[model samples]
Target: MDIRPALESDLPELLALESQSFHSDRISRRSFRRWLRHHDRVFLLAVDQGQALGYALVTLRRGTRLARLYSLAVAPQSRGRGVAGALLKAVEQGARDAGALYLRLEVASDNQPAINLYRKLGYQQFGCYEDYYEDHGSALRMEKCIRPYAPGGDSRTLPWLAQTTAFTCGPAALMMAMAGLPGGYRPSPEDEIQLWREATTVFMTSGHGGCHPLGLALAAHRRGFASEAWINIEGPLFLEGVRDENKKRVMRIAHRQFVEQCAAARIPVRHADIDQGQLTERFQAGANILILISTYRLDNMKAPHWVVLSGFDESCLYVHDPDLGDTHPRQAADAQRSALDCQHLPIARDSFNAMSRFGSSRLRAVVIVEAGPGTAPTPAPAT
Candidate 1:
């Protein structure tokens, strides 16, 4: 069978094949016709002698490097004949031609054959969904990097570590950055806790407090890397409202040690919020920034969380958010494709600043992890 773009005339056969492959969630002919006529979308069919065997539908959004594989179906008679594979290949090419850097799809968890095929094509499982279909079947969301995932590393996929405790965002974010570096640092749970112990303020509003920029940068520096820091708050951060004198004293002592370490190591400290322009300059100069941000802009409840702001452009910031659940939607897509959003999130610059502060102090802190000498710089991807 040959693969080619589907025409309006192919809708009836496309709907038929879709119905054959799906028991409950099949695309209608009307929807297929509309998608066929739309720009930034692709509908392709595998056919022989004018009879369609399979079809795929994909969607592309401007300003996002992601392409969604909304639908893919093959007729039962065409199973095991490579029809679905050919159609998928065509969809990938079409997506890349449309400037998509990633192709993402949601497949039913029970669909082992489809999962196997996708894995065979180098699609990595990045997300999941429960009760995703009309029949309440769960789904696995997968993505293929149409472009290299990062400028340098073991194939652009950053190793993600979920925070074991509420206050390990700093550790988790640093761990991800380490994993992406050339050394392939594999961080363990023990290291996670240790990093927090080394970096955190010990007390904030409640529970264990978040990390300080100097503390986090010092932690990275101790691990054979260089560090620079920019922070808005001075004279003991995260101590806005502690009625107890003892707790305030404890926070101050810890802050003093972190500051002392920075002074000894000569870690550059900027006692102000780094301008967006300066951030761009540092990124281009080959350093990854770890941002301490307020979750209120994302989750509506105010709390500090940490993330690696790995990439940026004039319009957007691309981050590997460690607290996946706390991140807000930069944009919403269907449930299947939504899984990829947490792994690598894109946020508007203006919206990010509004959320990057904490407490009544409006405190903002950043720690820079400088790329090692001779390490490749991250190139901005086309969105």
Candidate 2:
């Protein structure tokens, strides 16, 4: 099918397509006319043999980070071909040329095929709005950054730029570990009680490793949380003196020097100790905030790590895990008995406190800001 910019004459065909795709009673002709008059709206249509097959509608707003793709449709008969994809690509390129940082869209949650297609195109899932559409269906918000093209750089040869994808803490840690960061600090069950004592903030390292932690630390720093993570000698160190085991020993001897350096930069450092109970109590008292991190795993099992104890009941400790990947209050209870057990590692409320009390240096706390939904514009599809 030939793709072309939509003209006034295509309004009738566009309305007809919309009527066929949506409930005829819902999208009235009046609504279509109103849409046509909207300023800065980019509409496109695809046709073959004088028959309209698809269309896209986009809106370009000034002083925004991204262009919005508001609506896209492929005639029911033309669904399986690449009509929708081509329309999307064209709109993306157009947005990039117009100096947009990202292209954003919303898709119905039940439309798995569309979600998959968007994912394959480097779109990252960001958030969801409940009842965001006409039928009160949920909408999956997705975005793809349109990197400015450099004149001499070969797009084909360059590695894909790492887009700011979101993830929960646990899976994020695992990913970081797998990506060859310094992870795998599977603390001995016996080491748990000691670690909790020295820490003011518990940094749970889960998922891909330090990416979530780094991002969270940066965020916390912005929010006024004094954050620090002990660098294992064998792990990758993104920050100075934040390296593997050998460096840690040196850190212990030169503890004053390390503290001074961290103080000068407003970042604190202490060797890591894992504690389950004291950390939970601190969370309950509001002195400590847990940032649980995780990402989507293939099996759908809950990957919990680095949880903060926000509150507690008789059986469960209310905890916050950042692994939810969205800015919602992600709090869950840890069964008191189970939490006391040596599952992945050993942990106890008093044990962790005792360990911290005896450690040469205590755990460091960092400031972190929680991410939340902002007013993002609705995406329009290609005309």
Best by lDDT: 1
RMSD of each: 9.3, 20.3
Cα-based lDDT at residue 43, candidate 2: 71
Per-residue lDDT of 141-248 in model 1, one digit per residue for the tens?
898877654422112455566766767889999987766665446899999989998998878775667787788899988886778888887889878756677889
Residue pair clashes in candidate 1: none
lDDT of 2 by residue, 132-209 (tens): 667788889787756642111111111111112222332222222222111123322232222222221222222222
What is the overall TM-score of model 2 with all chains considered together? 0.39
List candidate 1 stretches off by more than 4 Å: 1-105, 108-157, 326-339, 372-383
Question: lDDT per prediction?
Answer: 0.75, 0.44
lDDT of 2: 0.44
Worst 10 residues of 2 by lDDT: 153-162
TM-score of 1: 0.60
Alpha carbon lDDT at 16, candidate 2: 78
Cα lDDT, model 1, residue 179: 68
